[model samples]
Target: MKNVNYINESKEVFDVIVIGSGITGGWAAKEFCEKGFKTLMVERGRVVEHRKDYIAEGKGPWDFPNRTKVDNLLVEEQYKIQKQCYAFHDGTKHFFGNDRDLPYNTKKGTEFSWIRANQLGGKSLLWHRQSYRLSDFDFAANKADGHGNDWPIRYKDLAPWYDYVEKFVGISGNYDNLPQLPNSQFLPPFEMNAPERAFSQQMASDFPDKPVIISRCAHLTEPQKIHVELGRMKCMARNECQKGCSFGAYFSTQSTTLPAAARTGNLHIAPNSVVESLIYDEATNRLKGVRVIDNDNLSQREYFGKLVFLCASTIGSTQILLNSKTNKFKNGLANSSGVLGKYLMDHNYNARTTADIDGFEDEYYIGRRPASLYVPNFHYEPTRYHKNFIRGYALAGGAYREDWQSYGYTDGLGINFKEKLMHPGQWKIGLQAQGEMLANRDNQMTLHATKKDKWGIPQIQFDVSWSDNEKRMMESSVEVASKMFEKAGFKNIQGQATERPPGIAIHEVGTARMGRDAKDSVLNGYNQSHDIPNLFVTDGASFASSAVVNPSLTFMALTARAVDYAVKEVKNRRL
Candidate 1:
C-alpha cells in the first residue's frame, strides 16, 4: 500500500508537485517518480487505501441500510446536483463530493450539474472506464468548422503516447481499424453475450456504415506481468465498480498509478490538502510553488516545486488559475489571452433511443459486463460533415434480456406472477447518443467577486448552456438511432430528447485550451503554459475540444506525452 501523509508543512522544494491526485495527477506522479523525480501529490480529499478503503465493495444491494438508495434529506441538502448521475447510490455516496460544502453559482436561467468526486482518487475511482482513442477527425474539427481554437497537436503526435499508457493500463478492446475511433494497444476483449452478438451482426447486416463493437475500457481482462506484479487481478465483471473494486480489476489511481508511483519510493502525498492557487515568481519568470488550504481545518501552507502540473478537474483547475491573481498578469495567472475561462464544453448526452427485440429469449448472459456496446461516430468524417451540425456524436448501449430484476418494478401479487417472471423476459436494446458539444465563448465561467468558500477561495459562477448545434446534433442522433432500430424490426421503439443541462456528462473540458498562439490559448501543444514554461495543466482543462469519445483515455495519453516533453526540457535546462 502507498503510505500517504496529511501534513501541513514540507521543507524541501520537490522536483515535481502534482495537484489533484486523480487520473492525470496519478499518471504524472507515476511517470515523474519512475524517472527518479521527488514528487509530491496534493489531494483535497481523504486518503482511500486500495482494497482497505473500498467500504462497499462486493456488497449486494440488500446489504445497504437504505437498499442502495441515498437518504432523501441528504440528497436535497448536499447532493441535489450529484443525484442526477445514475451511479449515485447509497453504496457510492461517500465517493461523491458534498455539494453543500462545495457550492458554485450558475447563471439565472442556465443550470449546470457539476457532478464531482473530490476524493484522493478524484473521479478516477468512479469513472466509467470506457477508454477510447481520439482520431485526426476530432483533432481537426475545430479548424475545419471554425468554432474553437485549433488543436496545437494532432492524433499522430499523441498516438504513441496512447499506446504507452494503454499497454500499462491494460485496455480491453478489439482492433476496429476505424478512422473516427482509433484502436489502442488492447488486451483480450471481453466476450459479447448471445443477444449482443446477434445485435452486432444484425446492425452490421442492416447498416454497414454504423458498426457495433465491444466498448473498449481500461480493465484488466488479462492481467499482464506488470499488472500481476502490481497485485492487480483480472476483471471479475461485477459491474459494481462505482462502489470501488477491491480486486483491482479496474484502472484507478489506487489500483494502478498510485502504487506504481509509490513503488519508486520517491512520492509524498498530502491528503486533505486543497490547492488555493499557484505562487508565481516574477523575477524568475517561473512558478515558485502552490498555496494550499487544509480541507478539514482551513489552515494554509505552501509547497515549492521546480515543475508543477495542475491535474485538477476542468473547472477546478481553471478556478485555481483564475484565482491566482498577480501584478504582472492582473487579470489572472496566464490569462493574457483573456480566454482562460471561455469556450467551455461537455458531452451532450440528453438524447436516448430504446426498442424491444423479438427473439433471443433462451440466450441470457452471465456476469455483468462493465462496458456496453459502442458505435463510433458515423457522421462528421474528415471527408464529410453533418449538414445540420458541424461535429458528430457516438452511440453506446447494449442488448440484454430482462431478468428477475425487472420483476421488482412490476405489479405482481400471486405465486403465478412470481413464477412467470422466473423465466427471462423479452430482449431489449438501447442506444444513447453522446453528442459533441461545440465550444462557445459565450458559455463560460468566472469566479464570483464577493462570494467565497469556507477555505477563502472565490466561488465559481458558471454561465454555460447548450447551443443550437448541440440540440441539432442530439436530434440527428435520435433520428439516426431510431431509424436503425425501426429498420431492425424492433417493436415499441422510443426516442427521447432530454432537457438536462450540461456538466451532467462529467466530461467537462476546454477552460484552458491548447493552441499555437499564446494570444488566444493558455497552453502550448505540450500542455505547458504559454506564459510559464515550467508550469503545465494536463487535465481536461487543457482540452481544445470535447470529442465524441470518453476523455479519460485521451487525458492519460496527453499527460504521458506532456510529461515526456517536460522532463526532457527540464533535463536540457530549457524549461
Candidate 2:
C-alpha cells in the first residue's frame, strides 16, 4: 500500500476510510488503525461520548418527563419508524434518528421501518446485546435448499475469530455444546430466577434437544483485565441498557472499538459527514476514495484511502454502493455480480407467545438482569421430525415478577393497589420467536429511479417479502412456543403473530452475499469483494443466509478474520 501524505487544498485523504461508526465501522477502524493504517471514520451524526452521553442510565422512572410514558406527539412527529422498537422511549429517544431529519421512501402497500441512529456510536449504543454464532447450518442452508447462494465460508473459518472477539467483548453464557448455535468463550452466565429455572428444568426434561440456556450477550457479567484496562466495569445488572450503559457494561462502539482504535493515534473521526458515494476509479478498477456530504451544511468533500470498508448497516451500505454508479460498474460500485441489493432479509420475529406463570410467589431476584433465557432451535435435527419447514426458529423468553407498574390493569382504589404492586405479582413469562427468513431474490431492495433524497441520492425502495417457506416456519414457531409454555405448566397462554415488516428484527442481512465464484458472489471468504479485492465489507451485507441465531456475533467474527487477512495481504503487498 502506498503511503502518500498529500493534503489537497479542497479534498482530504487517509490510508483507510470507513463509512458509518456503528459496530462494524468501529471494528474496521480499530483493525485498520491497529494494523498501521491511518484511518478516517465518518459518522453522519454528532459525537456521543461514552459515560457522559448516557444521560438516562442513572435516572429513575420519576425522573422522566412523562414518568416513563412516551410522548405521543414526539412519536407521531419524530420517530415513526423508531417507535416500532420497544426500546424507543423518553429516556433513549435522543439516541435514535428523528424521522424528520433522515427520511426515506417506502413502496405503496409495503411498510418498511428503517430504525436508525446516525450518531457517532450509531445503533451500537442502543442494540439488544444478545450475541450468538451462526453455524454451518446457516452457511450450508443455501446449498441444501437451493434458496440463495452457498456461504463462502463456514463456522470453522469464523470460530477462532469468535473466540478472539468474545475474549475481549466479554460474552456471558453457558457452554451448551449445541452445534447449531455454538457456545462462546464466556465470562459467567447470569442466574435465572426461580420461575425461569423451573421452566428450564421442565423444558430440559420434556424435550432434551431443546435446552433453555441463559441469553448469551456481549454485556460484561464479570469484567476481566482486558475489560478493566478498557475502563469498562461488570454489568450492574440494570436492564436499562438501551439508554446506554454508563458502566460500559455492554459492548458498544463507545465502550470497545472506538476507544481501542483512538488509542492507536491513527484514528481520525469526521462526525456529521454523510458518505454519499464511493469514488470508483474506472481506469484502475478500484475504489479510490469516498464522496461525502456534510450532514449539517450539505457541503461536499472527498477523502482518499488505500482501502475502504463499507460498515454502514445492511440497507444503508447497499444504498451508498447502488448510488455510486460508474461506467465500469453501471449497476453499482463493486456490483459486478449483479447482487448488490438482492436477497435482503431480516429475522422473522412476528410470531410470539406470552403467558402468566402461577407459581413462585415468594421467589424474587435482585438486580435488573440484562439477559433472558434462550431456547435454542429444535427443528430439523437428523432424527427429529419437523414436517412443515426446512429451517427453524429459536425462543428467547424469561420470567419477571410484576413490578409497581402492573397496577395499570387493576381497579383497586389507591393505597391498597400501590402496596400490592410494590411486592410483585404472579410470574409473567413472555417469549418471542425468531424464525429464519430465507434468502429470496424476490425479497430485494432497489434504488427508486425517480425518488431522490435530500442529498440527491436515490431513495431505496424495498420489494422484500416473506415466502410460503418463511410463513411455514413462523407457524411452526408459534406452535413450538405455545407447546413450550404448556409443557412448562404455564396458564393463560396466548399466541399471536405480529405480522412481518421489513427491518423489524434489526438483523437486516444479505445485500452483497458471499459465494464460491466471483461471477455469483460480491464477496469471497475473507469478506474481500470479488470484483474489488482492495475493498472489504464485513457487515451483515456479506451474510449468505439469515441463520436462526443473531448476526452480530457472526459479523464480529467475520470482521476479525477479514482484518487478519487484510493485514496479511497488505504485508505481502497483494493489493
Candidate 3:
C-alpha cells in the first residue's frame, strides 16, 4: 500500500480551476488568466515543455534504429487500443497511451478502441491539426432528423469565436464559397502538387458543390510577429508532426495556449495532479472545490475555486462527475437530467475506401505537405435525394507516388531495387470518408460495480456500438467513393473497409450533452451545469449532436465562449 496522507490544510484557492491541460483546458486557462483571473491548471501527466521535450521531431527516417519501423513490443504491450490510429509507431510511441496502465470494458456484443494520451499537452500535440468549423447543416442536424436534443446554439452564435481562435491559431486553406464547409481566417494555403491540381480541376467540373480543396490545417504557413516572438517558426514541411513540432509550427497546448497563458503572469499549473472529483456544497447549491490525488507521492489535497472548468477529455470528465457522489445529487454530481453518461458518439470512419490511380507518371510533389485535399459532403441535399440515409459524409485524400516500401515482393538484387525506387511511381489517389453518427440512448458509459484501477477509482464500462443508421451510412459511403473513382477513369481501383471500432476516431463526444431543457440535458446553452452554477464543461463531452466536421475547432470556440460567460457570472455574484 502507498502512503495515503491527506493534506487538509489552508484553502489556498484560485479564481478558476481548469482541469486537464489538453487543448480545451489550455484555452480555458489562457482566456481566464488573460482576463486577470487567478487560474490554476491541474494536469494528470508529466510536464513536457515546448522545444526541449520534442527530441524526436528533428530526426530523419534513416536516423532511426529500425528505419522508423514499428516495434513489436509496443504492439504487444502498449498499443493494443492505439493501433486503430494511423500515426502510432515506435518513434512517436511516447505521445500515445499505454493500454496496460489504463483499462476499461466494452459490452460483449460491441467493440470500441479508446485511444488516449494522458500527458501535459495531451492529444493536442499529436493531433492531425485539421481545423474546420461546422456550418448550419450540422447545427440543425438534430432538429432535422429528430435524433437527439437540438443544439441550443447555432453557427451564428459560434462564428465570431471561430474567427477569433482561427486568427490566433493560424489556419491555412483556400477560400471556397461552400455552405457546409465554411472558409476561415487563413494564412497562405499550402499549394497542391501537379497531379493533385489536375485532379482538383477535374473534380470541380465533374461535381459542382463538391469542390476538392486543400486541407484547412492549423499550421503556421507564415509565422507572424507574435508567433516568432514566442520562439515559433514556419513549418519545415517534414510531415512528422506526431513526434511533436519543435518549430512550434502547429497549434498544440505547449506551442500556443500554455505559453500564452504563462505570459499573463496569472497562470499556475500543477502537473501530475490527478483530479478525483468536484466538491459540491449542498447548502450553497454550488461547486466548492476539487479533490486531487498527487500522482508522484500518493497524497491527496483540495483546492477551492470560484469557478470550475472541466476540459478533461470526453470520457475523463464524465468519470470525474460520476465519481463525485454526494447526498444532494445521489446519482452523480450535478446529474439532475439523468443524461450524464448517455448518448456517447464518435464520427464513424470505418466506412473509408482506398484506391490506386493509374496515370500521372511524370508528376510529383516537392516537399512533404502536412495536409491533403478534401471533398465536401454531397449527400441528401434539399434537391438531391438518398433512399437510405439522411445525413452525408465528407471525403479527404492525397496523391502520393510509390516509394521503396513497395519492393517487398521483388526478386531483383538489392542495388537494382534501390535504384528502381529512386524516381516516383504512378500517382496513387486515396479517399477516406468521415460519416456522421447519430446520438442514440443505447450508446452510453457507466461505472462498473466490481472493477477498479491502480488509483483505486471505479473503472468505466462502455455500452456503445453503431446502429442501423450508421450501417446504412457506411454502405452509401462505399458506393459513393466507387462511383467517384469510376467517373475519374481510374483502373484496378479497390475499396477497403476500415476495421476500426467505435471511439477510434478520437472525436468522442456527447457523454454529457447540452440543451434548452434541464430534464434532458446536463448543461445549459452556456455550457454551465444547470444543477451547479459554478461548474462548466466546454469539452467535446458537452456537444448535443455529433457533426461530420472535426470537433476540436468548435471545442476551442465553445471554451472561449463559456469562459466569457463564467467570468461574467462570477462578477455578477451568481456563482
Best by lDDT: 1
Model 1 TM-score, 2 decimals: 0.98
Best by TM-score: 1
Report lDDT (CA) for all predictions: 0.89, 0.83, 0.83
lDDT of 3 by residue, 1-575 (tens): 01111132337678998998888999999899899998888888877877778778778878888877767786778678887687887678787878898889988988888888888889998888998998987887788767789999898999999998988888888899788888898889999887678778887888676778898999999988878877778987888889998788999998888888888778877777888889888888878788888777768888888789999999999999999999878778889899999999999887666667777776766678988988877763434436777777788888787766655555667777778878666667788888888888889999899998777778899998887777777777777777777777766677765556888889999998999999999999889998888899999999988888889999999999999888888788767
TM-score for each candidate, following the candidate numbering: 0.98, 0.96, 0.95
| Candidate 2 C-alpha lDDT tens digits along 116-164 | 9889888998788889987777677777766678887877888899899
- Clash pairs for candidate 3: none
Cα lDDT for residue 17, candidate 3 = 88
RMSD of each: 1.2, 2.8, 3.4
Off by over 4 Å in 2: 1-12, 380-385
lDDT of 2 at 516: 90
